[model samples]
Target: MATSGLLNTDILSDEIFDESQARAPAKRCDRHSHKPIDMYCQTHDKVGCSTCMADDHRSCQNTFYIPEFIRNNIYQSVSRKIQTELNKITKTLAEQASKFKQDKQRLLERKAELLADIRRFRQEINDQLDKLEKNSVNEIEDKVKCLESKIDDGLKQIEALEARVTTASNKIAFPNPYQPDVFVNMKMADDAANVANKYMKDTKIKSTVEELDFKHDRTILTQLEQIIALGSLTEDPTKMASSLFRIRGDKSYCVKVKSDTEDCYISSACCLEDGPIILADHNNKKLKQIRGYNYTVTDYYDLPERPWQVCSISKTDVALTLPLQNEVHFISGEEKMKRTNKIKTDFECYGLAYTNNNLYISDASTSVYVYTLSGTKLQHFSETQSGQKLFSNIHSIAVSKDGTRIYVADFYNGLIVLDNNGQVITTSNGKQFCGAKCCYITKAGSVLVSTYGSSVLQFTPDGELIGEVIKADSEGRSESLSVCCNQQMSRMFVCSIDDNIGVYGI
Candidate 1:
């Protein structure tokens, strides 16, 4: 029994050794030498042979035999560490997925709210129309009733006169008529005949036939046909945690944009986002797109009438007001300019601005008209809620980035700031705002005003004067008319009355 036990033990040992040999394989360095890897270089985080360590890791301070390194450093299982890292990654991915779901839910909620608002607006319009229809129907009914009542009165009078005449004739034709009765009947007949003659004369003067007609207001139908949507859809402005910094004009570049017989009278200008600056050359009757870096005209589009003011709608779209045509023309392109569409205004359009999918235009008289992108008149501001005129010779207009406030550059009223509802917030008629012709709102919410002369003044968003940014040149030829800043507030484009446009670094 002892001999069998020893043999069984030997067989078990041999089987265990063979299994270890089968599971583990010899590792060799995959270098040109192809040597067995037995050393670890902690500096390079690599495994190498003795020869490799001498040749490549001679200066490495942390070098050890592979077995010794593993014994000293590997306190935890590698598989466990890999599992921990993978679990952490999985948790992060789950959190990211949850955030995305929340964002999607918010978007869905916003869409639903917007749809409800549109429906409510449409319902209000329907209610108003119903009221108008009811009023009109009532008016027609009242007129018909009034005319019928007059005709009935006339018919009663005629019937009374006919009775008098008939009674008199019957009395006179009686077989045993008394002389007194006959004479009385004769007088009654004469009186009735005279009354009948008078009534006939009055009827000739009055209208015998009345025609009731409904004359609908053509303007209402025209407005309805022009309406593209109930209102505009825009993303809510994000509130940033960081405060905005004030910008200053650093340098100015004068570029000539005249290529016509008449000198260019650049009345308005707009800066695109990372794109060319557009200038409205009033004398030339053209819209010129010029590059800021090299100050060269890249493209130009001729207008039927002079453009008074221009505003950027998007990165590639812009709208310019044509005062003479009473139209707001929209042009779009990245590398070239082309007329896309237009909006005809009841008043002559002068100053123009676009914000939150709406266009605000000034008539250069007393009113400011607000319209949707598709030309539906949304609101008009001529007088304040207190019956005071909002502006005197309003020229250029601008809206705040958040679409909450409107800034008007009035020729005589100076800078007037109002809420989006046209309620006057404040009016700054400081000495620096003399002849305020054009106004621009920078990305940082600073207001830039171009006076009638060559000075371009800057003010805080609250209407406090910052300072004059640009002034007249040596020859006093820089008469700034329109001013605009790029989206980054890094550059400003100023349109002068002369043949040149001024580009200033802010």
Candidate 2:
């Protein structure tokens, strides 16, 4: 039915007229356009269509076809711009990192400095604390030692006081056993009275018979009275008994008899040169021996019941005292006889000491009687009041070598110092049991005291206790002490009731 040409033409028309529904929307171009409309393209941005470019967009500055533009340029200029911006951001980040690192380093350095300062300060504080602790410990130890020494000294003083007090109490409480009761001889008295009467009557008869005027014959009348008094004299045991005190020193001692005594207590002793003289004290009326281990001659002057104290004046002359009789007798060693230098006393004497020209005597009357070596009285000082402190008993006496001062040992008070004029200069108070017996002033100006049961105490001239020389045993009692002044030999000798003499070196 149809011809071949007609068929071909129909197919062409069908192909050419294919529907626009299958085509994508055209992109709007805005490359250089002042104004452009968007296109519906999935893969490309809004671009100008060919028609748009030929119309109003042809004069625009950025209007172009997407496909055409892609074909001609590879976007090299934009790529260059983006690369530059990325490089700048990276550099900025690097600079900021560097600054942060520097800041951290500074912080670390400052921390190190602060830590060092703290450590230094801490060390200084620790050092100070350590030093303070050590010093405190040392001070405590020193104080403890001082207190301990003081306690020891105090204990010693207490013991000495107890011993002396006990002895004194015993002496006072017990009565003497040797005291003799006196009775008059009635028969002898009557015979003497008759003889006196006969002589008187005969004389009176002769005078009256002679009638030679009764001129008062004073001499004859006095003789008659003497006879009458002699006739009445009675033999009494109490009067005949010898009132005596005895004190003995060691034999071979340079000083034999301080005074003279018929019988004496003698003990042999050894001591260092310049040691104090050792002497025995006799309170009870007991006959003493003249020599040690040997009964020497018995008849020596009218011996006292007991010689209390003896002092040697020289190699031949000695002064011995019958303290109870209140009398001192001088005797010669060569003749073994009493001298005429005898003197009687009214007070009871306890101790004797000698200076260069005089002798010092301590008495139970609490009086210090200073007398010349020749029985002449010099001065008296009593320790009673503040100015004159009277002691309960005078135990011992010591005079300075220069004779400027005298030291008195008071059984109650410690030690009393008196000037040459018999005035109290100073008193060692607060010293316990310091009243043993004797006190001595050393050449170094130290005072050495021999207490009863205590150790020897040494004191400075100013009266401060310095040290203790020796300690006494619990039962040992010190009686006397003597210092030797032989410049060749420096020694001190102490005597005790144990019948021993101790020697010490300076």
Candidate 3:
């Protein structure tokens, strides 16, 4: 039997992985039954000591000392063979690395070709559309010109007849009694007027050009959007980061809320675009708002029962959840607050969020409830029911800006991402997730979250960990209990159960 240490196993694995790896020849016996391999036991097919011969292989034949056996010029041959193998291995590694580089470069060239093809095809389509637009405009212009020419001809004929009639009238009024041509001229003028009436009748058709105008479909602009996004890129991955949000090693709070007063147990937090943050204080049975610029108590409202979660419905209205009562309350007012309606659910509602007049809520039955403003149940989440490891203990939930995805921060199972219609998109059954608490999605598609007894963290929309958003302070004072960022992602609000709320920039 053979036993291996950590370093020995690593070396063995590397040797097995790269079969070209050559190791130095062993100078001592592997088993170490004796102090040194002084003698070679031929019959036993091993090098052993005097104890082995006395106990087991005493009757073995043709055994010799190692020094005497190697006295016939064998060290030089062994060294040369080992050196040859080392050279071969070095050459093989160099060739393998060169081949990898070549393959990468080849793929890069193919990607460039693909991008060029996309641009070329798009340009061809654009040229065809441009030609169509030019022809349409040209048709309108030509019709306008034809109508203007007909109107101009009618105006010139009327002007000529009016001049002739005026001349004949002047002869009759000024008494050219001696001129016999006056009656003839008057007859000519009358004939010209009759001809003008005929021309007027032919050209009297409506000249309204409004019929030439056409209507356009605005939805075509939406369809003109990218049919597919290019996937391959040589740019650095770090460039994909947002300019407004960042993760740094150093951490500190901009403002601390209720640090000097009694500790406030904040259960939920939500904010609008750079506005004050609304917090649900379950212990105090109130909904409190904290100013973003100056961390002071802006406004608050007393609730009927312990409110578990709170979300902003409009600029001045918010929806609150009461798990003890198994209902949700919708309150609206700016300066004067009032509770307008209450929604009762079958199960206990834990967390509540609003998106596009529709509410997404979490309850006890391993499913999220969707409701309209009038308290109609639209649907429930996911075909796969919530169970032990992955979907267990969903604490907070949020929907994407486009209403395509939903994010739920589970207490035990990290973050679970789902579609808007309640289908699982991603699950964190095996990822490193601390006690995840409140969660929010930024407009830039970043997820900011806080975990119990841990720091706030930022992750990509697809659940790739970006880094820590904020760390616990040096005093080792308290933990992050709730976290929320405004829609603009310009400001963020983080709250702890221990009566401390801090605001930070993106």
Per-candidate Cα lDDT values, in order, are 0.76, 0.51, 0.67
| Candidate 3, 170-233: lDDT as tens digits | 7666655766777776777677677767777876757577666776855454233311132223
Q: Lowest lDDT 10-mer window, candidate 1? A: 7-16
TM-scores for all candidates: the values are: 0.50, 0.38, 0.49
State the lDDT at 402 in candidate 3. 68
Model 1: per-residue Cα lDDT at residue 361: 90
- Name the top TM-score candidate: 1
Per-residue lDDT of model 1, residues 108-138, tens digit only: 9988998998899889999999999999999
- Report the lDDT of model 2 for residue 173: 51
Which lDDT tens digits does candidate 2 get at residues 1-506?
12322112122221222233334334334554444433212222233445554564444455544343333334444445557778998999999999999999998998797778767877886797688667867776776677667657656755665554555445545545544311123333444455555644654522222342324436544333322121121234232222111112222222223343223332111111112232333432232223212212222344454555455556445565667778766655443345657776668776666668687877764778888866777888774446645666666666775777777666677777777777677777565655555665554545666675546666554444565566555333444443222112334445444333444543
Which has the greatest lDDT?
A: 1
Q: Extract clashing residue pairs from model 3.
A: 264-499
TM-score: which is higher, 2 or 3?
3
Q: lDDT of candidate 3?
A: 0.67
110 in model 1: Cα distance from truth in Å? 39
Instruction: Arrange candidates by TM-score, descending.
Output: 1, 3, 2
Sorted on lDDT, best first, the list reads 1, 3, 2
